[model samples]
Target: MKIFLLTEAGKNIGSGHITRCIALSQAFIEKGLYPYFVINGDNSVKDLFKDKKYIIFNWLEERKRLFNLIKTSDIVIIDSYLADNTLYKGISENAKLCVYIDDNKRIDYPKGILVNGGIYSLKLKYPKKRNLIYLLGFQYTILRKEFWYVGKKKVKKNIKDVMITFGGADTKNITTKVLRLLTNEFPNFNKKVVIGKWFRNFNLIKKQKDERTEFIEWADANKMKELMMKSDIVVSAGGQALFEFAQVGLPVIIIAANDKNQLKNINEWKKTGFIEYAGLWKDKNLENSLLNKINFVNNYNTRLQMSYNGKRILKKNGSLNVVSKILQELTNKE
Candidate 1:
């Protein structure tokens, strides 16, 4: 079977869509299927599709080119928030089967498989449609292979090690603000900050670097897993990073990125006791919220329970499970 992934990634758009699609692509490869990516990303986004078979086109000027790829492929999987209803309908008409990967219902789906693989996927309301196969909640969450089976995290009594990550693009530049606040509070502690492939404020972040601070650039899934495993607590953005950190049983303080859906996810995670919500990055009182949450998560018992809660909530082989379902659907039609 041939799978064509219709997605986009960049500094301004963030990499969550492309990253999750890559997880699904890996799963397709493991099943002896060919997956081709159809992207509209720029040069900076090319690194994300390093070894994968992909073709790029200007979606605005040359979107007609995608219909050819969709027509040839057995399945068309879309993970783009920027795509409109007309784009999805066009692809759906051409492809044999259409699968829409969604975090938020940002757009009207094109009547196929709709996967909302997040913490509160079960709670979100969807439009009524019989043709849509709903793969709701964490069971279908797409995670990298490194996060599939991770060692349990050991929470330290005194927050010795900290990992600060705000998604792949981090367009809001939360990493710098977070580091500034955290280092002042606990300068001696081991602090690791992830500078994404698209992050523009490298000099600002580099200026904050000291003996205790380490800045990692362009960290792949394996590298991210390594960092998550070593840290006692993580101050991260609410996206795919949440699932990865949760899989590794690391306690996290979530700062919602630009999306309202992210804020919804963070609040839901807070209720589960797996994470403490530090409000939106754009909030005026974000500094105060981060400070309080940092101090709150310092306790050993609190971090320990947070670790356990995260693991318990996200206990599933997400990528593998989603692939199995997709493959099963493909074979059943044959």
Candidate 2:
């Protein structure tokens, strides 16, 4: 079966969409199917697709080329914030199976599968339509293969290590701000700061590193999972990473890094008791609010409960479940 995964990533656009697409692609590969990536991104995204099939071009602009490439595909999965109704309709019409990966109801998607793996997807109340196959809620949350089968996490009694990770772009530069706050407030705690590929403040962040601070740069999924496992607690941007943190059962404090979707997801995930919602990154008192949450989660019991809630909500088989359902749908159609 020919499979094509469509998404976008860049310094300004962020890499969350591509990250989840890669997870789904890994699921396809495990089924002995190699998926082709059609990305609307810059050169920075090339490293993420190493040893994989991909073609980088602005599919939004070059619709003809994109249609030409995926016209004969058995399956086409599109995960994007920029794609419009027209673009979606084109892909839905062309492919034998069209899957739209959604975070928020960005548009009234055309016929095919609508996959919203967000924790609060069901709450959105998508209308029941015969043409649409809805794969909603945390059971379908798309996460990297590394996080698929996480073992039980050992939550430490004392919060010694704290991890700080914004998304790949860190467009609002929340990492450095949070790092500086951590350094000043939690002097004794070891800080693991994840620096993304498109971090413009890399030099500034590097200068802030001290004996208690370590920088993890451009880490792959395995390395990311390892760090999350080792850390006592996490301060992260409200993005796809939160799902990964939940998979590992880590207590997290989230900063909605200037994205509406992140803000919405953070609020929903907050209700689950797994994450503490620090105000948006642009808020005037974000630093103070984050510090207060950090102190609150520092308590051993609080962290333990958060960890428990996280693991309880996510079962770590989301990717496989999504793939299985999609394939079943394809079979039924056949």
Q: Which digits, one per residue and each the tens of the lDDT, describe model 2 over residues 248-317?
A: 9999998887666677677778788999998888899999998899999989999999999998888647
Instruction: Report every candidate's CA lDDT.
Output: 0.82, 0.88
lDDT of 1: 0.82
Task: Write down the RMSD of all candidates, one decimal each.
Answer: 1.5, 1.2
- Identify the candidate with maximal TM-score: 2
**Candidate 1 on 226-313: residue-level lDDT in tens?**
8988899999887878888888889998888866667777778888889998888889999999999989988888988898988887
Query: Which 10 residues in a row give candidate 1 its minimum summed lDDT?
Result: 60-69
lDDT of 1 at 11: 77
**Candidate with maximal lDDT:** 2
* Candidate 2 TM-score, true structure as reference: 0.97
TM-score of each: 0.96, 0.97
